[model samples]
Target chain A: MSPAPTRRWWAAALAVTLVGLVAGAGVALSGRALLVVTTTRLPVALAVGGLALGAAVLGVGALRARRAAALAVALAGAEDAGRADERARHRRFLARLDHELKNPVTAIRAAAAGLPPGDDPAAVRAHATLDAQAGRLAHLVADLRKLAELETQPIEQEDVDVAQVVRDAVDDVCAQAAAGGRPAPAVRITLPTVPWPLPHVRGDVDLLYLAVVNLVGNAVKFSPPGTPVEVRGSDEDGAVVVEVADSGPGIPDDEVGVVFDELARGRDARGTPGSGLGLALVRVVAERHGGRATLRSRVGHGTVVRLLLPAGAAR
Target chain B: MRDPAHVLLVDDEQAILDGLAPFLERSGLRVSTAGDGAQALTAHAAQPADILVCDVLMPRLDGRSLVRRLRADGDWTPVVLLTQVGESYERSAALEEGADDYLNKPFDPQELLARVRAVLRRAVPGQPSLAAASTLVSGDLQVDRAARRVLLAGVPVALTPRASLLLDYLMTHPGELLTRERLLSALWGFESMVTTRAVDHRIAEIRRALGDDPAAPRFVETVPHAGYRFCGPVTRGVPTSGPRT
Candidate 1:
């Protein structure tokens, strides 16, 4: 059997007390009245019932408030934990960056210091290896640091020329394409011939360029030497729309949305060098500028990436 | 005229400036510095620099504002931004503000130097003239840079912005190895996540577009552990499609 309800138990006990009190008072106030007991019972019964109802209502309201408070506390704790974890991760990443920067300098210094004139071919190869590794580490660290910084700051905003941004991106990747012996993708800038400062955007110029650099760089990396990467931009929906379309293999449908999360990597794709924070960084930067980054792809066809920033906000 | 490019470097970290300036100067460039945006502007006005190398974040007016202010003045000096963060937002902002180039922090001195040289070369007048062999070709395929057109088999193939750039690079240096890092940085405009397999995807797409077999590629050959290479021969004026291996 269920335990007696606390409310009911209390009500019964209080009713007995009230009845006894009223009966006693009636006996004292009225000397020897025959109907006194009956009269006392009625008043006592009403008092007990009203008190029980008021207590129950108050208890329920308090319980609800307590639960809401607990939830708020839990959420605050989670946010704090997230911030701390991010800090620790950032420190490690920066440490890695420092090590990377020092590696190249160490190598060059060591090689220059160690190698006597007329060193053997093997020694030369060793030096070259050190140099190459140093360069690699440097690049990796730089990329990581960039990813981290983009996550943390307010990018400076200004009136920037979108078309120029495209041209600059191509130029930046040219050396890489040449080094790979991959053909540089063809560029066709189709902005209005009459340029008017190309739309002033409010954002961090360096960060924006890097974001575009990453897109163009990725295109060059994945595309075959002779295939093309199409870059197109226009003012759409009151925002500046920049799209980088590549003939390369497209992202899988399921992985598109999550590609922007921190350290997210695609399934079926592996063995490439990166910290997996690139897209996450891109998303952070885009949102900071009051813009957005999106991706679309078909398995056999290719991938197209769109970055949208509010148009007049560029000023 | 200043023979050496005068550069104003803005960074909150004193050590970064201390280490960078000497290294840059050693590369035969004159370097100046600012701790923040306000200082950067004052210094910039005091002595107009040929180029600017500023960090993305700083106190009292960060690097972005510095670039914008300079551009607003119609100075048009080339600027290369530096950053600790790898986000596209910062990169996009820098580009919009008339920045010529950008480099992520913890970069190689050599890579930074190369970029500096590239930017400065473009800024300086008449360097394009020194590029006597500017027209790059591969297997009778040619690109007329001045006209901004690409031709294959005596016909011009309309290419999108990215394709043209890819072709341009391939034609410029026909037989060298290029790594994925280099290509991604140049094309995508930002260094992407390290785990991305996008490079392979892009290569496949390019091969398909070029009608080349991955098994036996002709114009573009994959150099495992290295990068991609263009393997065709060409004459400047002739327009011929690259051979399928």
Candidate 2:
């Protein structure tokens, strides 16, 4: 069906014709002697043998070429599809950004309208209102920026202090936990006591931090107040694995893959407020780190998200 | 206590400061405002403030960063954050950074006031944890926080963590109008933007576990807009008809 295969078919046809001519010429040139020494079956046999051999060699070459071309086309199509998906994801991200931005703008407007301010009840209420709305907007922008950085850049691999990163992440979210009005979810951080001083792996620490933040935050977010969110790290099959597990409603077995799509909230998470980009962002960051994220969950149990980063590209 | 709670409010917008400054002051609290986190930090350090009320979004310093920077310097002040409709992601970041509480935009002034006061109370030396342990008792239903167990008519009822916590909070405040904010803060923390319907969904799960009829309404009474109430006459201790005692 392909052009290369068709060309090969054409070549085979030409070869067959050439062999037929040569065989005919031989028969004619030896006409009298050939007739005397050979029966009619001899000429026919010679012609058939020559043609079949020519066809077989060309056909094999055509088949191989066809297979290779098919593979190339498939890969091309996949890349195209991925590009389209990326574009679509970007659009969704922008839409989310718009929605997130609107609130603060609305608040700022309201706050300003009531200003020039002293200690009026109206002014005080406005101040608090503006503070809260602006806060929401800042978070949205930060997440958006993270997405952009990941898309436009590549991580530089270097010796990263895994233990230090973990400590910083915990410290980062500790205050957030307290501010959210729930007792800080107990964080059980378990890592090798020894500073493994893992091989320098190429990665962007900031991006990885964002990924860590998202995972830890989600663990705390989904869990009930006072529940523990655990962060565990270990070496698995030569890769450094980090896992964040929560004692909240786990993803359904069937929806595990669906949870990593941009703006794709889980079935049970429908009405809950989520960026929907959390898992998607995590997935991207994991892959960028030369690793991937896998989720294991039981319906009534809990969800554990594991990020596997290759230990400094195998020596 | 704590100098009657001096509050430092930070936001890029002046209108909000204009409106909320007076309301907070009238509520027996002194208020200060900064247009951004940098200014806030400066104002906060000029004179020690009891609390930091901050916006997550700003020109230079964001709420999460403000908290992060503050914590980096070993400065711990209670923070209450404000979020928008889809900014649940920020809620976690804000909390992770050490913010004390968060309220969504278009929030009722009274609700905001309540949240601020609640955060302040918890931040105060002697006040109980914002999510202080409390038991809810309704007819045939008893939720014990200390034991993390529930009973229906003297019978122990099995509940998922979320369900047990939800029922426990409801049962503890029998007659009080438990606002959604309070419930979310008590259960998932203010970082979670749990929908009212989700609350109903969990309540349904609770009722199913209790083997109670929603139409007839035995234990948890659904109070539209205001939150749930424990209407069932409950007695604490021992299982009578719920799960295996």
Best-performing candidate as measured by TM-score: 2
Per-model C-alpha lDDT, please? 0.64, 0.66
> What's each prediction's TM-score?
0.41, 0.44
Q: Return the interface RMSD of the candidates, in order shown, one decimal each.
A: 8.6, 9.5
Q: What digit string (tens of lDDT, one per residue) describes model 2 on residues A1-315?
A: 246766766798899999999988988888655544535697798898889998888877877777788889988999999987986688577657755564554455444433445689987787667666555554455445445445544344545565666666776677666667657678899987566634334575545666777788788778777778899988767788889998888888789978876668888888666778788788887877778998998877788999888876621
Per prediction, the TM-score for chain B is 0.58, 0.58
Say which docking band candidate 2 falls in.
incorrect
Stretches of candidate 1 above 4 Å error? Answer: A1-113, A117-119, A170-199, A225-228, A234-238, A253-281, B1-245
Residue B83's C-alpha lDDT in candidate 2?
56
